[model samples]
Target: MPHFNSAHTQVFQNGELTLGLMTPFGDATHDLADMEDQFRLAAMADELGFKALWVRDVPLMVPQGSANTASNLDDPFIWLAGIAGVTKRIALGTAAAVLTLRNPIHLAKTALSMDRLSKGRFILGLGSGDRPAEFAAFNEDPETRAAVYREHWKLLRSALSSSDEQRSVLRSATGGFDLMSKPASDIPMIVVGTSRQSLQWIAEHADAWATYHREDARQQGRIGLWRLSLEQKGASLNKPFIQSIQLELSSDPDTATEPLELGLRTGRNGLNRYLAGLKTMGVSHVILNLTLKQRNAGEIIEEIGQYVIPRFPP
Candidate 1:
């Protein structure tokens, strides 16, 4: 495998935890209308020393439930390209792009193009996809998504490989079409969720692993499992672990934490301590989704940038 790209190294240092922001930051219903403001805040985050900016891939507005009602989301590649134009250094990534639903050739081309456009600051996060409606729309059977995921993953990896041996193998298998463009460096592939695979599979194939937020003890246990998987696979134990959280920052800097569904409502101090604990437990990065209902997103970002990020420098 190729070495870590610039973005991967910047965001996933072993024994350290870095912070990133989730893009399209506002109430889901209003995200499309808030694009200009979103870019402005994205630029602000870049300046404020955040490590990366992540965007989601929601191909259709499939309402999964009351909590997961689809929002108008921009295509992850296009959105990240726009963000790349606005920011200089902060890494740009997909929280995950659905691998089973996209053609591997196109996906590899787009990822390489984005990596070039971002000047080597792109990370490719992949998922097997979870929504049955999305699978049906793509004329795929969700029942076989796991097998599809593995197949697509192999094809995508072969397409993206810089190794001459790998490239030759890919060409022989595909009967000889070239990818045409090359990445600035290796593009990091982080497996988001299980993608219907075992921990051992992820540990063997992924550059890193990304998962959702959980309680501290549960998260620690998950990290333990990840470590054990890496050990069992003879992979690097330093391979990073990532998690995302929905944050509602309180006005008072010292306010105590209150748990939300997959995140927390907390002040700067509480947030700092929580992130510190994550670092100790082996989390390499945390993506913050600012669920701002009562404060300006910029204000909360600025607060986190000033008070929280400084303590956990990338």
Candidate 2:
């Protein structure tokens, strides 16, 4: 069995739920010309006891819609490295790095470098990627993404593994070349979304699984299916389930939950209750993407740190 690193342990525990924040912090309309303030808020989140900080991967600016506007304009690895420099204890991660577009060897090397820089406080969340334009841009076929994902995933794992047996296998496959550096510690790979693969595949490979927020009934059913898949594979069933929410936090602490496209508009109390319910249903972590239109991101982080996080203590 692989040992859990600091990042994994900080954000995940069996039968408990922790909170995380997405990067590009502050108002959605805020200027991105300067990342200084963003780094400052990230440090504040670390000080305020947020468990992990997540960054997204968007290689291209193909606009999806009004609802899916891309805010993560920077490269995921470089962005997390910067975050690692500013924050002390808060774990850093890619919300979902597009696996099929990049070479597995390069991706693994960058991930290992980030892990070392963060002092074992890095989690790698990977996805197969869905955008057709992105696939075309990379000169990859969208139709073959599933096969590509499985192939690259194996290579990436081999590159990241410290075991001589695994490295030998990789060398044999790659015509005698070797990846020189190894991770400082076991870096947890959280498979984000379905990744165009089966639940069984994810259960067999991923250290954890992350998905976007869904309705309670659907989400619970998904978790049950994940557990069943693990059981079928005869693997440990304690792997965590992570979810992301696009939150528009209301100032009124007791305001009721109103559903948005991918998340909710709720006050601190409502958010706490919702997270408690998710925890009971087997979610291990919730990544909050603040969609604040009125309040400052710092204020909401403080409010959540004071009220919501205590109810689901990390």
Candidate 3:
């Protein structure tokens, strides 16, 4: 198999945890996000040496559910493509692309095009999707999604093969044509959550793991579980583990951490200490979601770049 491209290797280095910024890049207090501001935030993150920038794949805006609640208002691929053009080196990724909703051939081709356009700097984070309304809208069976997920995953893997021989091994689903534009090298694929599959299945197939962030103690246990699962198959888990969290920066340098939705509210000092603990617990990358912050998004990014990021330098 071909190795992952330079951006993947750089962001997921062994024995070190790097930071990434999730898009919409603003406080959650609002309903709308500006496109120019989003682009500017991505550029700043790249300039500040953040390892990656993540965008969510939300195909439909659910009526009153969480989808309609937040400011994630763009197609992840189109948005990431815009960011890729302006940024020089920051890795671009779909926090996850919902594999169940998209055709595998389409997913594979679009991903390859993005990787080529970005010069080998795309990470394909994938998931089975959690929204029931979406499944209904697409006329897919939510109950049988696990089977669909597995089948489509196999198709995508076959379609995106870096070797021409491997590409030819599987005939197109229609048995009528050959897929084109294999990635320049393997695009790193991070399986998100279980995607309704077993741990062994994920460990065997994924290049990395991107799961939800949790308290340090619980997260360590989760990583331990993954390691044990891989070990049971007589294999070592050499791949990185990644997580995404919400962040709220307080002005006081010594402010204590308080509980929030997916993350915590804390000062830069507290944030640094917290991230250091996560790194020590075996997390390889932390994707920061700036949704619930009270400070100006730009200022918070700058402060993190100046203070917190130096402690966990990429």
- Give residue 239's lDDT in candidate 1 (0 to 100): 93
lDDT of 3 by residue, 1-314 (tens): 45678778879878898999988786433565788887888899888889899888877765544455633367889888999989998999988899999998888889888888899899889999888989998998899888988888887776666776656534757485765656667788778888999988888887888888787778889899888877886664667888888888897879999877678888889999888988888899999987543678888888889887788765
Residue 240 shift from truth in candidate 3, angstroms: 0.8
Query: Candidate 2: which stretches are off by over 4 Å?
Result: 26-33, 66-72
lDDT of 2 by residue, 37-57 (tens): 788889989998899999888
Ranking by lDDT: 1, 2, 3
Against the true structure, candidate 2 has what lDDT? 0.86
Runs with alpha carbons beyond 4 Å of true place in candidate 1: 30-33, 65-68
Q: Name the runs in model 3 displaced over 4 angstroms.
A: 27-32, 63-72, 169-176
Give lDDT per model, in order. 0.88, 0.86, 0.82
RMSD of each: 1.3, 1.7, 2.1
The residue-by-residue lDDT of candidate 1 on 77-111, one tens digit each, is 99899889999999999989999999888898899
Candidate 3 is scored at a TM of 0.93
User: Candidate order by TM-score, highest to lowest?
Assistant: 1, 2, 3
